[model samples]
Target: MRQATLDAMDEVKRSLDGIEAARARLASRPSSLGGRGLDGVFTRYLDHGSKQLTWLRGTLGSATALAGVASEVGDSGMELGILQMTGPRLQAAMFGTLLLATWVDFLQLADALLRDCPTCGSEKLFADLHRVQSRMTPTLADLASGDSERIEAAATAMPVLMGELTHEFDTIRREARSAMEVGGKVMVAAQVMELLALISTLNMSLPRPPPAASTTLGMGLVMSSGGVIAGSRLVVSAEWVEMMRRLVQAGVISLPAVSAAVRIHGGQVMMAQANQDLPEGVREALGDSPEVRGMKVTGKAGAGMAEAPRHHVMPKEHREWFERRGFKGDMDIDQFCVRLEQSHHEAIHGGANWKLGRTWPREWNQMIMQLLGKSGRETGRALTRNEILNIVAENMKLYDIPMKFTKGRRR
Candidate 1:
C-alpha cells in the first residue's frame, strides 16, 4: 500500500510537470487578442490543473503516512486475532485497522481521480487548444489587413469560436473541480479519523487509579510534615486526584463505545471491499486464487472449462465511453470484466424470460448507462473506474446476483 501511494505521488508529480510545460507553451504563444483569447482560457486551464495536481500530491503524502503506520502495526502482529485480546493493545489494534481501511479508501479514490481525469495532469487539453488556435491563424492574420469587410467578418466569427472554446474550458474546469472536491472531503475525513484514534489511544494510556492513589499518599505525607501550608497543598492534591479519577472513569466508560463503532465501520469497509466486481487488491489480500491468464479471451481456465461466462462490468457496448475516460488501450477494458455463472450473467442483464416493458423499465446494462449518464450530467465528466465498479456492485446486490467466485470466501 505504501508503494502504491508512492507510485501515485510520482504520477501526480509527473502530471504537475506536464501542466508546467503546457503553461510554458501557452506563455510562448503571441497573444494577439491581448489575453482575452484562447491564451487566457488555456492559461486558466493549466493553472487549475496544476493546483489540483499539487493538492493530490499532498493527499497522497498523507495516505503514505497512514499506509506506513498501518504497515508497522500489522508487522507488530495486530491481525484479526488481536480483536479477541483485551486492554490497550486491542484498542490500538482496532485503531490500526481503522486507519488501514481509511488508507485503502484514499488509495482507491486517488487512483480513480488519476484515471478519470487525464486533463488534470496531461497536456492533451492544451495541445487541442493550440491546434484549434493554429487553424484560426489565417483568419486572425486577415484581421490585420485594412479591408473593413474582412475585419467585420473576422470580428463576427472569432467571438462565436471563442465563446464555444470558453464554454468547453468552463465545463472541463467544473468537472476537475468536482473531482478534487471529493478528494478534499476524503482527506478531511481521514484527518478526523486520525484525531479520534489519537484520543482513543490517549484515553487508554492514562495512569488509571495508581497515579491518583500515589498523589493521595503524597498528600498524606505533606499534611503530616507541615501545618497550614501542608493543608493547602493537600487540598490541591485531592482536587488533582479527583480530576484524574474522573478522567480515568470517563475513559473506561467511553472506550468500549468507541471500539464498537470502529469495529462496525471496519466491518462495513471490509464488506465494501468484498463487493467490488473487479478482483484487484482486495481479492489478493483476502487470499483468493490468482486470476487465470487468457481466461477472459478463451473463457477457459487451464484444462477445464471456466466456471462461468465472462461479464463486462462496464458493458462492452459502451467501450468507447470507458476508453475516452482513460481505459484507452485494447485490453484495458477487459481487465475490468469478471466471469460469472451463466445464470448470474443472464440475471444481471435481465434473464431470458424477462421482458422489457412489462417486467422493468431497464436491464442492468441500461441501468449502468443511466447511472453513467446521471453521474456525467452531475459532474460534467465520465464516472471513474472505481465509481463505475461501485455502481456495478450495488446493482448486483440489488438484483440479488450472487457472486460466483466470492460466494464461500471469508470476508
Candidate 2:
C-alpha cells in the first residue's frame, strides 16, 4: 500500500512537470513572430488547472470520509481491516491533497507573473508564492500534534513535497527574469521602427523637383516666390503636416521628438535646395576652403537686457528664414545658428566669404540690385526701395516662400 501510494504521488508530480512546461511556453510564445496572437493559450490553460484542482479536491474529501467510516466499522467487529490496511494510503492522499493546493497556487502565481509584465506587477505574485513555499516547508514540530505514526507519515511526505516545490520555484524565477530582460529592449526597438516607418512614408510621397534654374536665376526665383516658397515646397513634399496631425491624434511618438524631427528634416531639405542652386565654381571653392569668417550685429535692447554683439550673417533676411523652420535638437542655439549661417552663405554665393569682414559686401548689394531689376516691370537700373519691396512681395506670393521682408539696406 505504501508503494502504491508512492507511485500515485510520482504520477501527480509528472503531471505538474508537464503543466510547468506548458506555462513557460505560453509566456514566451507571444514574442515569437508566428505566435503573435496565441496569447489565448494562457487563458485556456488557467481554466484547465482550475477545473482539475476542483475535481482533485472533491475526490480527496470523499476519500477522507470513507476512511472515517471504515475506522468505525472496525470498532463494531465487522472484521474489515480497511483502516489498518489503508493507513499509509490515507496518509499519502491527505499529503498529496495539500501539495495539489500548493501546485494550484503556483499556477496562479505564474499566470499573474506572465500577464502583467513589462508593466511589471510581479510583486504580488511573488508574495503569494512565498506564502505557499512557507506552508509546504513547515517544521516537523507542526505535525507532532497527531500520534507518533501520523508524525512519521508526515515526515516521509514533507521532504518529497518540498523538493518538488523548490524545483518549481527556481524554474519560475529564472523564466520570469529572462522574459522581462528581453521584453524591454523589444518594446523600445518596436516603437523606434514605427517612427522610422512613418518618416519613410513621408519621404516616399515627396513632390518632383522644380525645373533647374541658373545660380543667379534660381536666387531671383526663390526670392520672388514669396518669403515662403522654400517652406511651402517642403510642406507639399511629404504631406508631413497631415501626418503630424494624425500622429498627434494617435499619440504614438512623444510630441517633442516629433517636433524636433520635423524641424531638422525641413532645415536639411532647404539646405539641399540651396546647395543645388549654387554655382559650380563657388561650391568647389568652399570644398577647398577652410577659413571661417565671423559676422556680428547688435541686439535690440529690452528693459533689463544689455545689447550684445551677435554673429551677423549675409543676406540678413535669411537668418529669420532658417529660424522659422527651426533648429536641430542635438545642437545648442549658437551652434545651430552657425550651421544656418554657413548653409545660407553656401546657398547664395557657393562658399563662405571669410575674406570679407562683418559688413555686407558690395558684390551682394549688386546681386540684389540685379535681382530687383530682373523681377521689376522697369529696366536699366538697380531697383528703388519701393520697387524692390513690391517685387519681393510679389515673388514671395508667386513662389510660396515663407520669409518676411526687411526694408533695412544692409540686408
Candidate 3:
C-alpha cells in the first residue's frame, strides 16, 4: 500500500508536467487583439492557470511528505492519531489541487477555441474576463450569425463543458464535507469509548474508599492512558486507514477526463443558459427543445412576472405602516420585514428575532437569492420596495398576515 502511495506521487508529478505543457501551449498563442492577435482573456487565463499550477505543485509536495511519514509510522496508534487529524486537511489540499487543474484545462480549451476562431478573433479585452465570460450570449450570437462554424461549435460546446465542471465541483464539495463529518464523529466516538474503558478499569481495580493521594495519582494515570488509547484507536482501525487510502486514490483519478463520468443535471445546464440572454440563433443551436424553453430568466416565472421596468411600495397600508414606525432608508424595509416575522412568532410562541438588523446583510442577500432560485450573475436588477414587500408577503401570508402591497407604484 505504501508502494502504491509512492506510485501516486509519481502520477501527480506527471500530471503537473501535463499542466505545464498546456500552460506553454497557451502562452505560445498571440495575445494581441490586432492582426493574428491574442486577447486579454488569454493573458488572464494563463496568469490564473499559472497560479493554480503553483498551488498544485505545493500541495503535491505536502501529500508526498505525508505519504512518506505514514510509511515510517507503521501501525503506531499515536502516530496514526496525528495522521488521522492531518487526513482531512491533506484530502482538502488534494481536492483543491485537482479542481484547479481541471479549471486550468477548461481555460486552456476555451483559449484555444477563441484564438482559432475567425469570426470571434482574439480581440484585445478592454474589460475583465469575468465581465465577458459572464455575458457569453453576445459572443455566441456573433458566432452564430457568422460563417465561422468552428467558432460556433466551440461556443455551443462551452456551456456543455461548463455544466459538467459545475456538477463535478458540486459533487466533490458535498462528498468531501460528508466524509469529514463522518471522520470527525468516528474520532470523537473512539475517544469517548476509550474514556469509558479507563473509568471501568479504575472502578474495578481501585480500592473502595482508597487514600486521597492514591486516588488522585490513579486518576491522573487513567486519564493519561485513556488519551493514548484514544489516539491509537484511530490508527488501529482498518476502516479509517481504508477511507484515507480511498480518498487518495480518488484524487489520483479525478483530474484527467473526469467530464466523461460527470452527469450534467438540468439545474446546472439551466443556470448556465439562464445567466445569459441568448439569441434565437444560439438558442436553436442548443436544441431549442421544450426543456430549454421551459427555463426563464430571472424574475419571469408564472404569476411572478412583472411587465413594469420598476416596482415600488404603492400600497397605502404599507406606506402608512412605514411612516408611523418612523423607519427610513432602504435597509429599513428589510428590518421591517424581518421584525414583522419575529413579532408574529413572538406573539404566538414568544421568541426574539435572533437575526435582527445589520446582521450579515450580504449573507442575507445571498440567502435570499438562493431561496428565489437565482444566481448572483442572473439577478440584473435590484428589487424595489414593492418587490421586497411582495416577497415578504409570501412568507407573511403563510402565517396569515395581510399582504396589502400594490403590485406597482403609480408614477
Candidate with the greatest lDDT versus the true structure: 1
lDDT, residue 311, candidate 3: 21
| lDDT for each residue of candidate 2 in 274-332, tens digit (9 for 90 to 100) | 11233222222122122101101111132112332222222454444324333112111
lDDT by residue for model 1 (202-254), tens: 12212222323533322211222222122232212333223222322322111
Q: Which stretches of candidate 3 lie over 4 Å from their true place?
A: 31-41, 82-86, 121-411
Off by over 4 Å in 1: 1-307, 351-360, 397-411
TM-score of 3: 0.32
The 0-to-1 C-alpha lDDT of every candidate, in the order given, reads: 0.37, 0.35, 0.36
The better-scoring model by lDDT among 2 and 3 is 3
lDDT of candidate 3 vs native?
0.36
Which 10 consecutive residues of model 1 have the lowest summed lDDT?
78-87
- Give stretches of model 2 more than 4 Å off: 1-39, 67-80, 85-89, 119-161, 178-411
Each candidate structure's TM-score, on Cα atoms with residue i matched to residue i, is 0.25, 0.24, 0.32
Model 3 Cα RMSD, 1 decimal? 27.3
Better of 1 and 2 by lDDT: 1
